[model samples]
Target: MDLTGKVAIVTGSGQGLGLAYARELARRGAAVVVNDINADTANAAVAAITAEGGKAHAVTGAVGSTEVAQALVDGAVETFGRLDILVTNAGMLRDKVVWKMTDEDFDQVLNVHMRGTFTCVRAAAIRMREQGEGGRIICIGSPAGQRGNFGQTNYSGAKAGILGMVRTWAMELQRANITVNAVVPVAATAMTETVPFLKPYVEAMHNGEQLPSFARRELGFGGPEDAAGIVAFLAGDAAAEVTGQAVGVGGDRLALWSHPDMTTTAYHDGGWDAEAIEQEWPTTFADHLESVGEKLPEEASAQ
Candidate 1:
């Protein structure tokens, strides 16, 4: 994990998971650029890194803006001479069900999580290609994107979009040896505060079985450090060949995501006939329910 002579930029690095990633990367010798919306937090992180004998600078700005995201990349190269790693860790949450969600809430999450990630990755990838050197692009994602959550339609959409972007960008940038990967971190952080109801669900998702309310307290929840290690690995040379992948990080719950089974083909030939399926699958709906059993509860599917 020695990143000596390498320059890294971590968005939202002023606190929480992003700060952990920046600090650990700097400790391993990467000259870090800590970006945050709060000037004081960003400055504090940078100062701490410097005090520990690491190279770092603070950039305070909203990551959701294209200008600020680009500035972070450009600032790294301008101050440190090159950009080697770009971590899109900046994010905010607006919790609401689809019916309860507002236009503003949806737009805000999409802007920060999806557009902000694209902005930094686009800027850094172009620079890396121009420099004729391989680079690492790491994005922070969440489990809600993989498995739909009850009240996070906006956040899920944005994070799912990130997974798609990472896959495509990996193919596009592979020629230049720049890898794009994402981490579905279930670690407790600021973002989790907005989804208090989902905390139990997340615990069940990690623990693999529903726990009694009294025993739930004993279920392990990960911290920022747990996520930072995986991010560091992805940002380092050790993971050079790993690209276009989404990895989940939870204590005792590290595994590739499980995709929704798509065996129910509604097409006969080259096209789908909605009318035909409506007639043919009169019993199909019941069969599907029996097939999935308790996983697809009647009340849950009503939504």
Candidate 2:
């Protein structure tokens, strides 16, 4: 859609990927509500948009709270009269392996990422349903969720939960014309710098900044704008037929999203035969792996 008169509320729009998405949307004629916990950053983003001849306003509040979520929706309606798009982009990280993870670490990540997404979506959907003109809900996901990360159990779990929620929301809201899709982006941002394991990978992504010598060996990293384009499309009429799907945007590549392989094949018939299972189960795995012309990797096969 052109979005000339639409209103968009983008959570965590104070900076980084969220700011890029909100600014780009406003540039396309949407009146944006730049929502962020940092009042100064949110206001700065709005000011920048207005300086560029676009309509935008800042709404500062915690994204994890229902009250703040409602306030953001209300701000959009109060300022622009109606809501057309909601970008649930607020998130934080508390990286730790599952074994080393603490209750506080896990709960904090879930609260900010998963619960925060629901807060904004729930509040926005109410407004969209009331308006009866349809709306867009675009969420931010991560590859860490798709391929489990080494030290980010909490982050991956929250991101994966979003995809599950997206599928359910699509089934319930499609008839109302509200499309809910997610963008799994691997862009360089401030969050990346704080993670010990991800710092070098992210620092290499700085557009005008210097890259470390080691980073020169890798292809490169993506900028925030690289992922914003897809979000804009999802929020517009161009993606009217797309819903309940996650798009992976990383650097110069985009992928048709896939979920984890959670299924295991076993020989079975209409009834479970103890004798058959005992006789065939041991050989099934070896035979299957051999058929692929390669043995399972030594580490995994040994296990």
Candidate 3:
């Protein structure tokens, strides 16, 4: 439960879930590099951690570029002596359906979420490998990525790509003793507040009203702090053996998500032609068809 002497970096730590992760890591005795694009919030985060008797430094800048990523790693190493944990939690959304999504919307989300994660994790990996002391790389994923969501063409695609990279990095970095995993968190944040169906629940949380059991238990929605523990846990030695996992957390709920796999398969000699596929689809594949889009109960939505 303690992370004494560990040096860590948390991206997008100015506010919301990223800030929660930074605070939790610091509380556990890790020296943290708080990174954000905003100067005020970044400085505030560093100050808050210092007031709590934790060590922190602010490195303000947008992520996603090689230079920024390298600068963050350099900042952590220069300030704390060594780096042990890296949380690639910086992200943004440009929600729009496929037809309505402009190039700007799609490119921007991918640049910040997927590419940002890539550059940051790549820089951390290089450093951690050189240190040969082992390290933790925690990436952020979303339920929308697991299952498609309406008006989130850009977001869902980027998140899904991040998970894909996590699995690959888990294998690639295993020899270096670096563990990689994803935390699929659901919380009341600025991002979730923008969702049309979740506005009331977000407002309720801000107003200090109790959320319904469904929101807590089923939707796994709660304050950002509720989801912060998993990040802290994954960053510590206790979770050293855990890697290549998508662990979900929120209020009243914690669960493991299965990786994507082929559910059903059939073999046909020389591969089936169009007519042959049509003939066998009903018996061989039709029964295994899968549906997309986020599925929530009517009760959860109506709330």
Candidate 4:
């Protein structure tokens, strides 16, 4: 996918998966605007791209801010001449079960991941529409959002909300040819390293040691580059028809995710009362009910 002369803004490109995405886009001949809240990290990314003879500019600011989002779009147009792709990867985690999660924790995560993505996409879409060329808007999602995770209500909620935006925007912007999609990446980034169960393996990988078979089996080959390829693919023209979907990327695996839909339904000529519904509930839907975190008993036993 040659992105020669394309301009892209990748938020939170200072490190980890975001950094990998920025580097890959730049490598593909895209002039990148690397946005990070941290100035040092942003500068380092910009320097690395320049060292490799790729064009890039650093924009440091909080992604959740409307002003910052607008500035990022403006910077790309001012520096690169026009904007063509936007990858909203800026996010933070505040893991806590619903009861223990504070307002601040929930708000911060939502603002950065959901609200920030909306702000950036809205800003970029305006320019893309006016420029008269379609654009690609890719938002970062998480497995935690698809299937709920313990102690991650805030993070999961925000990530799931982002997917919703991806679907909505994909349809809303289709007329302008702007495609919006979500990518759920599983990699050993700083974010995953925070999980106690994955920490040892992630640290070992960082030290160049081979991961245990179980870790390898569960998380696949763990690295940010593993996820970057998919993001780059979606940002290119080849994926113009691949909007409104969630794609999973990890190791050498790439999978398409199914959207929510009605699997089964019960109908009554007249709406049944609570008591009447309770009487028919078992025959109506119990057999099809699914467990939260696992397959049906028959499938689980087979596995």
Give the number of the best model, judged by TM-score. Answer: 3
What lDDT is obtained when candidate 4 is compared to the true structure? Answer: 0.87
> Which pairs of residues collide in candidate 3?
none
Worst 10 residues of 2 by lDDT: 290-299
Model 2 pairs in collision: 1-236, 1-237
Q: What alpha-carbon RMSD in Å does predicted model 2 have with respect to the real structure?
A: 5.2
Writing each residue's lDDT as its tens digit, candidate 3 over 179-291 gives 99999999999899988777888999999999989889988889999999999999998999999999999988999999999999888899989998998999989988988
Residue 48 in candidate 2 has what lDDT? 92
TM-score of 2: 0.85
Per-residue accuracy of model 1 over 1-303 as CA lDDT, tens digit each: 789999999999999889889989998999999999999999999998999999998888987777897899889988999999999999988888799999999999999999999988889998999989899999988777776677788988998899989989999999999999998886666676445443654556466664443222322236677677887898888999999888887554565654345655444666557876677686656466423111333332442
> How does each model score on lDDT?
0.81, 0.82, 0.94, 0.87
Q: How high is the lDDT of residue 200 in model 4? A: 76
Model 1 poorest 10 in a row by lDDT: 291-300
Query: Per-residue lDDT tens digits of candidate 4, residues 38-100?
Result: 899899999998999899999999899899999999999889899999999998988888999
RMSD in Å for candidate 1, one decimal?
5.4
Clashes of each: 0, 2, 0, 0
Which ranges of candidate 1 are over 4 A from the true structure? 197-220, 258-261, 266-275, 282-303
Candidate rank order under lDDT: 3, 4, 2, 1
TM-score of 4: 0.93
